[model samples]
Target: MTDPAAHLLIVDDDERIRGLLQKFLIRNGFIVSAARDAAHARRLLEGLEFDLIVLDVMMPGEDGISLTKALREKLTTPIMLLTARGEASDRITGLEAGADDYLPKPFEPRELLLRINAILRRVPSVSETQSAPKMLHLGPIRYDLERGEMWHGQTPIRLTATESALMRIFSACPNEPVSRTQLVEDLGRDKGVGSSTSQERAVDVQITRLRRKIEADPKQPRYLQTVRGAGYMLAPD
Candidate 1:
């Protein structure tokens, strides 16, 4: 058999689903980790850099969307949300909430594999060059895109993989508004949010985290401003 192409994290409340998905994904050539819920997932994330995260939306507490939002603060691993709710609005909501892809429940495992492959395809290969802004001025913070490093004055500020990836994406098109859906796609995350409120709620958490780093006050963001109805924009000075 071929070696595993990537490492995967599977988070679900249901023991059965988690076990099945883990076994299936491993068989298809992936090293898999399983988490019982948000708390467990958080612990796993702190210690691992996963290639992808397969998350189920409905859970006992701190549901998938909440976890997704929290994870985006520090990780760029791809996420695919699975749920029993299959409404069209639900799917759109998922995208708005910063999910890369969404699949309804009772889906064939093969279909999940196909979707996983499709999302992985969107990721740039290691050899591909992602030319980025040499140095970004985020108020007092200076970020080096190529090095994935950040500095406040002469001191260095650590950036998690997710945070570094975010800076790279935003710097690529400074002064441009990036929709939550686009950001989700760029970050390679997938999860569920069924309406405008849900979408904004999830996206807001991520933006808030980013703002705290560069803004004098995250509550009243000066650098990353909301675009009324459009989306979030990064205005670097």
Candidate 2:
């Protein structure tokens, strides 16, 4: 179940579909907002923060993929693309653009609900009460386990939802290699959504993005290392 206060932004050019999704998601315990196109979505995004974004791929002005890529430059909000195109390449393109998930058009509301909940579940929850901070050090980077935040000295670093999830998984077992298949399962990418290979590749993309934040040089990562024939491992200092 998703947090009842979880806010969602629905961006679709079609009024009928946008209205229907807003009503459906609201009925399912989400606070929903609707946008007719990417421009409207950007306007809303500037003033308000949303737990997740449900974006349509075929918008008139700026398409979902372009908006997603742009938003990822500053925001860490999770985005789920709704695409009419079902090709694996299209889905991978969405993932490459930093979308957390993609649901092809003509999907059942229930499946969307499931996917939304899964992504929300992956997001780390902040406790109202404070506890001693558990820190993981990677070069100059510091990750707080309890708060699910990363820091460089006094400045905070932003992490997307999927990147946060991956950090949680790796931080739990530092210096241990985790297989691509296991990483897929931990990230909640179920079978039948896309081929296993594509899902692993998506994970690779996410890892590359994350390395940019944690490693001094992403191309030659020192903390997040790849183990030959095994998988990736986090060796924190």
Candidate 3:
């Protein structure tokens, strides 16, 4: 079973298909959102983070192929294209456009579930493993990934519940950019209406506070660096 926590975005011009997919996925233990076309999908993308995007290849405006290519330029989210034409060439085009997987139309809903689960399995989680490094030193501050504790020498630096949650998310994917929207979702604040700007801003504030606890120079961060167009990344020593 895929993590019931995974969120998916469905893009299709057809209203009926969108609604049916949304309901089916939700019933099968996933959070689902839908967009009418490429333009609508872009608007949602700005404010939200999705685990996977299930796109329909044939659309009226801004076909799925074009949007899939554009999305690859900015985000690393996985995409699965649904095309009515099951030809080898059409499938090849979708894959080359940067979609992680593709499915032909008239396919069973059960098959869609299987594909989504498979893709999500490839996403790495942050939970510390016995094998992965546990102690991370960032200058004077030290963190225990296993215990989610921060220390300054022998003294412990306390973290709020929200701060602790952020640490876990960042530690799980150390040296990787974790989008602001994904941070909000991982923190359990994404309520599914859309990605909340208020929540995004909240994450920024939390990052600032976290810097104060760890960075030797919070003014010029060395560990928690912001990726220009992406988001924040935690680079531990």
lDDT (CA) for every model shown?
Answer: 0.73, 0.89, 0.78
Q: Model 3, residue 15: displacement in angstroms?
A: 0.7
Q: Which candidate's TM-score is highest?
A: 2
TM-score, cand. 1 vs. native: 0.60
Residue-by-residue lDDT tens digits, candidate 1, 144-177: 7656677899987744334555666677788988
Candidate 3 residue lDDT tens string, 1-237: 768988899999999999999999999988899999999999999999998899998999899999988987677687889989866556657656766566887888887887777666544344544556888888888888777678999998865445666777787788999999887667544532223675565467668867877888888999999998889999998
Task: Return the top candidate by lDDT.
Answer: 2
Better of 2 and 3 by TM-score: 2
CA deviation > 4 Å runs, candidate 2: 126-133
lDDT of 1: 0.73
Regions of model 3 farther than 4 Å from truth: 125-237
TM value for model 2: 0.93
For all predicted structures, in order, the TM-scores are: 0.60, 0.93, 0.55
Model 3: ten consecutive residues of lowest lDDT: 187-196
